[model samples]
Target: MYDINTKRLIKTFTDMAKISSPSWGENAMRGYIVNAVKKLGVTARQFRSGESYNLLLTVRGDTKRKPVLFSAHMDTVTPCDNVKPVVSQTKITSDGTTILGSDDKAAIAMFLEGLRYNKEIRMPHGPIEILISCAEEVGLRGIKEFDTSVLKARHAFVFDSDGPVGKIVLQAPYHSTMSIAVTGRAAHAGMEPEKGINAINVLSEIITLLPASRIDHETTVNVGTISGGRATNIVAEKAVCVLEARSIDYRKLRKQEVLIRSIAKETSARFKARCAISRTLEYSGFTIHPDAVISQIAATAMARIGIRHQFEVSGGGSDTNILNAAGISAVNLSAGMQRVHTTKEYVMIRDLIKGTKLVLSIIDIMR
Candidate 1:
C-alpha cells in the first residue's frame, strides 16, 4: 500500500527515472502514469494526438469551484535514454553520457505522490486536475494540442521551472523568429567579380546596422544562424540569415521587428539588391499581477509550508505560457533544480523534500 502521511518521495522519483520518454516518444511513459494514477481510484485517461498523447487525472471534491490544475510535461530533451542515475551524498545526477530527465519528471513524481498522500489521509480540498503533457521539450506542441473544452480549471500551476520551490514565475518573454533572404547574381571572382551582386555583403550590412543583444529594459535580440554561399571563388548569388527576438512587452517586440525590417530594407536599397523578410510568432508572453487570485493562492500555500514565496519574471517560456494564453491562469513554479540541461544537473535531497512539503502544504491550505 502507498503511504500518504509517510514520505514515498524516493519510490515515486525512482519509478519516474526508470521510464524512458523523449519529445514525441512518450507513449510508454504516459501509459505508466495512467496506470499508476488509476491505483488512487481517481479517473485517469489519455487523449491521443497523432503519435503522442496527453494524460489527465481528476480527483473529485465537494464543489467544482473551477478545479485547480497541476501540470507538468512528460517529454525530456534528447540524449536522455539509458540514464544511469546515482545519488551520492544528497544530490541525484546521471553518469556522464546522458541527461537524467528530471526537468519535468521530478515535478511529475512529486505531484502524483503528493496526491496519493492526500488521498490516503482523506485530505479536504477542492477538485484537483493533473495534466501530464507530451512533447513539451521540443515545442509547445503537446500543450497546443490540448482541448480546453475538456478543462474545468480556472487556475493552473505549471511545475516546469528550475530553481527553489517557493519561487513563482509570473512573467515570460514573447518569442519570434525573423528571417531575411537576399537574392543576387553569381559571377566568377577572378573574371566577373564586378558583374555580381553580393548577397552576403548585403546581409552583413543589415546585421551590423540592426540592434541585437539587448534592446531597452525588457527586449532582447540575437542572430542565431546565417547561411547560403557556394564558394569563396564565387560572388555568392544568394544568402539567408535567421534570427530571433524576444520581449516581455508586445510594443517593444514590435519595435524590434520594425528595426530589423528597416535594416534589411536599407541594406537592399544601398546595395541595389532584392530581399525578403518574414516574421513568425514562436510563443506569446504572459504577465500576472502580484494580486492576481492564482498568485495569491500559491503565495499563501507556500507561506503555510514555512517557505517564503517570491513572484518573479522569467526569460524562458514554458507550458504555463500556453495555458495562460488559453485563458487558464497559470504560474510557473520552481523545483530547486540546479545546472539543468547539463551533465552536472542535480537536486538536493533536502530541497526535494521541501518541494514536496510545499505541494502538500498547498493542498492542505486549499480547503
Candidate 2:
C-alpha cells in the first residue's frame, strides 16, 4: 500500500484547472506542466505539433524490464478562459460560468503527484514514459502530427476517459466526419421564389434522410452544425452542414458512411441541385482484449488498491485510438472526470487520490 499526498494532489489539480488550455492553444498549460515536472527533477522533451507542442518525459529504471507509457492531453474544450475551480469537501467544481477543465488536467496532476511520491520514497520501477499531448480536443490534431516512431514503449495507458477510477476503456469507436455543401440557384424570395432552388430546403431534406442519433448499440451519428442563407429576403443559393459518425466496428461505420453519401447524391439529383460531399476518417477504432497484459496489469493495479475493475466500451475517441493505430497497444483508463465538455464538469477528491494511487500501483506492477 502507498500513501498519496492528497492535499498536494488537490492543489496541483486546482491550479492546473485555472490555466486556459483551449484546443490549439495549450502553450501556457504546457509550460506550467513542464515547470511542475522540473521541480521533481524530471526533464521534458518538447515536440512541435501544429499550434502547440507535445511533451515527453522519460524516467529511467531497470533496463531489463520493458518500458511502459502513460499519456494525457493538455487541451480542453471551449469557454475555458479564466476558469475558476471551486473546491468543497467532497469534490471540485467551477463557478457555473465556465468549465472546470478536469477532462485531462486531473490526469496530469495525478501523473505529477505519482512522480513526486516516487522520488520522495525512491520507488523501484521500470522505464516509464509520460506523454502530454496538445490540441487533443480539436480532433486529436496534436497526437496525429506526433511521430510515434520515436517512442520506445510498445504499451501505453491513456488517462482521459470519463468514469470512476476503476473503469477501463478497452474499446473505442472509429470516428469519421462529413461535410456537405448544397448548391442551388439564388433568386429574390419576393420577386421569383419559384425560380430559386432554396438550397437550405434541399439540405434539410438530405438531413432528414440521413440516419441520426444512436443508430445502434455499436454505432452513433450526429449532425453538429448547419449554415446557409445570406439574408431573410433572399432564397439561399448555398447551404452547408457538418456531421460525424462513429462505431466500434469498422464495417458498421463504413456502412453508415456509404448510406450517408448515397442519400446525399440521390437526394441532390432528385432536386436538380448540385451537392458536394467530403468525408474524412478522423481516427481508427481500437480494441484491447481483457486478457491482454496491459489490461491484466490495470486490473491488478485496481484490485491491489481495493477498487473493483470494470471494462467498458467508449463511444468517443482519445489519444488511445491514435496510439493503437500507430501499432502501440494502449488502453484508456478513467480519470474520474464527470459531465465532461460542459460547464458543470467536476471530479471527486477521493477519485483523484485513488487515481494517483492507481498510477503508482501500475508503475510498481510494471517494475
Q: Against the true structure, whose lDDT is highest? A: 2
lDDT of 1: 0.83
Candidate 1 lDDT over 1-367, as tens digits, reads 2234323676676567667898889977887788788778679878875579988889888683457888999888867778777776677787867777778888887787788778778877788888989988876888888896798888888888887678899999999999999988899988989999999998888888888898867899999999988999999989999999999998899999998998898889888889999999989999999999989888988876678888989988899988998899999998767678876776666667777776777666564
Cα lDDT for residue 76, candidate 1: 86
Per-candidate local distance difference test: 0.83, 0.93
Q: Give the number of colliding residue pairs in candidate 2.
A: 0
Best by TM-score: 1
Q: Given candidate 1, what's the lDDT at residue 155? A: 88
Estimate candidate 2's alpha-carbon lDDT, on a 0 to 1 scale.
0.93
Give the poorly placed runs of model 1, Cα more than 4 Å off.
1-7
Candidate RMSDs in order: 2.1, 1.8
Per-candidate TM equals 0.95, 0.94
